[model samples]
Target: MLNRFLLPALAATLLTTACTEPPKTVAALPILGERDVRPRADGGPADTVYAAVPAFRLTDQAGQPVSNQTFAGRAYVTDFFFATCPGICPKMQSELLKVYKKFPTDPRISFLSITIDPDHDSTAVLRDYAQRLGIGDASRWHFASLGDRAKSFELANHLLTGVVPDSLAPGGLAHNGTLALVDDRGYIRGAYDGLNAGQVAALQRDIPVLLAEIDGRKKGVAKK
Candidate 1:
């Protein structure tokens, strides 16, 4: 009789404790890409070095050099497109605009749309294109053109997108509508299909997560 009563009481106490405990937190977004484990100089823990976006300078709409340094300390979403794209460009830009509108005034975020047809999409052309999209702040929403068409294609590859000159394709160029989310450290954290609403929604959800992790790191707070 004593054992039966004690077991029931113990079970009830355990159930109550479990119900009152705090909920578990969602873990931080994983840093995407191949990483190398290296020993720290301070002899603490081994550091994992992730692959980062290579440095390249692009001529922005304002004819300014937009390089990795330009986006220092800020997370940016980048996509490849040409100003004259008649097929997917318009749709992709419209989708990206959704993300831009979400953080238009956010100082921690920026947008970069690189033109694959730089020879045709001049600085003035890009500026007008941006204006048509209601983007007045070039610093925040940069429509940049890289004059070296081959280099531009190479850069797109680094962002996990492909760009090729196809006369049969729209605007005489072929490209994927991939929106890549890069962290402040220039690492590719996420990539989404700009043409797909569902993937874009995931991108929207992830941007804040990365931003929150960055902020927490700065404040010496751990992100769960």
Candidate 2:
């Protein structure tokens, strides 16, 4: 799993190594990922396409289908975790709970927790887990899995939170506590340290900025 700091480093790689610096603004968060330059159909400037998350099919706690379409027109916070995790999972989820409470009923927001130990965290188990966490709304918060360990890990990597098996690790798995924020367009807008309260607070602040950006786009208003 990649450390939280690695996200900023990955974003900074696009910058020149010279003394020059890009102007910083709070109105819009930077999109983080590899990109491609392509010719525009309008024959205008070439478009730079950031890597968007690929579509995936998952089963939620309620045994309902969950995919990118489930979050259409909404922004979501996602993390990788197993129900039996003995290390950072509890604290990470606790921090995420804070963000969830802030927008528990907001139709524009959602949460996703992808389990790497699907064999042990079946839909019934995940349903019990979400109930234990007091997350009663499956529509607002989804505890989902790909139903295969390898497939789950592969999907985690696609979401930028890599997961792997490790005999020495807690619960026989090694993964980071990264809370990834994805906008409605399926582009990653932010990544936070799930174990750090300050970073989580930063995530809380950034969510509204992202939501505002989404609203601006809907109204044909340019984002700052």
Candidate 3:
């Protein structure tokens, strides 16, 4: 009788304790001081992300209207350059040409090249430039205009805020070769120094990371 009571009491105590005590939580891993391989917070990233493309109406080389909505649900890599740029621009274009070769024109992505010299780079000029870079492939690449130098300079300062005076020449156009990596939502996620090989390599690695992040966000896998 005593042994039977002891067994029942022990089982009852365990049941009560389990019900009353809290469960343990596993700890997450850390990475280089950031939160392990997870996506950074909104504005937590070096570049902030916009939910959608900004409201701006522009035209492509084809004279087709390329508005903000044109980039919806699509990621793109873009930089500013004039067709007759004397320095840096050629190298940047070459680097981007490589990037275009790497990723086919998937609907998920596009390559945008906005001419800083839109006045000189008319539709005919841009059309010829596109021809030089492999025009047959229409899926993911574009060369467009951002209007006059005033509008172009304003966007560089107001929107990009990433330009400087050029010293290589007295009155030559001053600029940076940094390529903005925009997400499908038209938010800038990251940037790359398109003129440098090492930076291009880093961009290559980060490109996939960004694409994956985009996919996760769409699937609701990204954490808030």
Give one digit per residue, the lDDT tens place, for model 3 in 76-144. Answer: 777888888887888999998888777775567788887777788887788888888776543367788
How high a TM-score does candidate 1 get? 0.84
Predicted structure 3, TM vs. truth: 0.70
lDDT of each: 0.91, 0.91, 0.70
lDDT of 1 by residue, 1-224 (tens): 89999999999999999889698696566667678999999999998898899989998988889999998878999999988899899999999999998998999999999998888899999999999999998999999987889999999999988888888997888899999999988999999999999999999999999998778776774433
Candidates ranked by lDDT: 2, 1, 3
- Model 2 spans > 4 angstroms off: 1-26, 39-44, 221-224
Tens-digit per-residue lDDT, 1-224, candidate 2: 57688887866875645547667665879998779999998999999989998888999999999999999878999999999999889999999999999999988889999999989999999999999999999999999998889988887887778687889998899999999999999999999999999999999999999998888777774433
Error of 1 at 219 (Å): 1.4
Write out the backbone clash pairs for model 3.
Answer: none
**Reference-based lDDT, residue 71, model 1:** 89
